[model samples]
Target: MSHTLDTYRLLGRSGLRVSPLALGAATFGTEWGWGAEQDEARKLFDLYVERGGNFIDTAGTYTNGTSERLLGRFARDRRESLVLATKYTTLRRPGDPNSGGPHRKSLFASVEASLRQLNTDYLDLLYLHVWDFTTPVEEILRGMDDLVRQGKVLYVAISNAPAWQVSRMQAIADLRGWSPLVALEIEYNLIERAGERDLIPMAREMGLGVIPYSPLAGGVLTGKYSRADLTATPTGTDDGTRKRFNLGVGAVTARALEIAEVVKEVATELGRTPAQVGLAWTLRNPGVTAPIIGARTPAQLEDNLGALEVDFTARQLARLDEAGAIRLGFPHDMLASDRMRAETRGDLKIEARQ
Candidate 1:
């Protein structure tokens, strides 16, 4: 069945009802050499909320905090009605040792700053932005729990973390009676299916809702980029948005363009935009609670929202899946081998319930 913004889904094992698609505020500011300015950002926010979207995601360090500030102003009247989520742990100051990290001091400091920028007394959800290998998992969990106890945060989550560590941390939180991570955010898209190897499965097994970011593969899946765009060097006078994004972490590749071609073909067959087809593929996953949609303009946001209405036939889904499928690697492939499955199941005619 097709879904809509008002077709609220429970986030993970939690009772938090979030929209099927989340509005990402990373494009709320122009400080990144991209993104919408305040006026345009407000229009995007208004359009999403008008369509019944309530889950909005941002970070404390996004566009140097401009994203949060703009979101704060835009969401003030509807603050209580929105499921506002933001992350911490990214450095606010370049050289400060305690300004960032998943430790206690950094968590408190970042939350305080986020609260100020958001103009909210408490955050509906606070995510440990990224895993800093330095801190103990217990330290981060206990700190997040403390914030919940103090009423500064409602729920705790983790983003861009390894599956093994996150699994361990969730276990520790369960045993210690601390607030557990209710969500897992990661860069998930057709081009970047590496998270499917572990992170996606772990979130389902561990009761953390999978919130996917960059579901459009930095707009590559929108079919705007071509083979020439991949190899061309920038002249430095252009917009620099796509160039800088392509060079950033999890940059686009030749294989990604191949996947985009499939997305484009499917969109053509279905009479939908490539962005809608690409985003719809992510939504098809039962484990994915939401795919954060980032847009620099209201028109782009409208196009992305149409993804909720896009549906795929079995053949189309299979084609898209095969085109973007990643090798499970190591143990996963080994365990899924026909011989291993036969051995594990004693060659019985039993179907495994996934």
Candidate 2:
């Protein structure tokens, strides 16, 4: 079945009803050199809300706090009706070690700053933006539980952390009666399926909803980039930051462009845009609670929203999967091997559990 902005789904094990797709506020400010200005950002917010979208994702450090500030203004009247989520853990000062980390001081400080910028009394959701690796898991979970007790945060989540670490943290939270993570956010797209190896499955098993960012692979899956375009310089109309970022992460590989070609082919076959096909592919995953959509213009936002209406046939879905498939590596491949499965099951036809 197809979904829409109003097709609310429970986020993870929580009762929080969020849209199937989330409107990312990272593009709400132009201080980053590639985001929308105030006027255009307002239009994006209005359009999404008018269409019944209720979940909004932002970070305290996004666009130097301008993203959250503008979102505060735009969502003021509808603040209660929307689920406002923001992240912490990014460095706020150049030399201060305490300025950023998953530690208690950084977490509390960041939440206070976000509340001020968002012009709100409390946040609906708070994510530990990234794992600092130095703080103990107990410290992070205890801090989050304190925030929830204080009514400053409704829910706590994590992003960009190792699967093992997140799993351990969740276990600790459960044991200590602290607030558990209800969501896991990561960079997931056709070109970046590394999350599938462990993070995706871990979230599903741990009852944490998977929220994928960069669902379009930094616009590569939109079929707008080509090998020839790789050498081109950024113009006023185009932002080179994403391309450079993609390059740095090795997301702009030759194989990625090849997968984008398949996306384009499927779009042509289904009479949909590549963006819609690319996003629909992600939405088809049952593990995915939502994929954050970012846009610098209303036209792009409209185009991305159309993804909710696109559905692929069995063949098209298989083709897209084949084009972007990655090796599971290590135990995954070993467990899925025919000999191992036969030994594990032993001819008894048992209903497999997810």
Predicted structure with the largest TM-score when compared to the true one: 1
The 10-residue segment with the lowest total lDDT in model 1: 234-243
What C-alpha lDDT do the candidate models reach, one value each?
0.91, 0.91
* Candidate 1: tens digits of C-alpha lDDT, residues 195-310: 98999899999999999999998898998877877666654653726556664543657888899999999999999999999999998777689999989899999999999989
Residue pairs of candidate 2 with colliding backbone atoms? none
The TM-scores, one per candidate, come to: 0.97, 0.96
* Clashing residue pairs in candidate 1 (N, C-alpha, C atoms within 3 angstroms): none
Worst lDDT run of 10 residues, candidate 2, spans 232-241
Which parts of model 1 are misplaced by more than 4 Å? 238-240, 247-250, 348-354
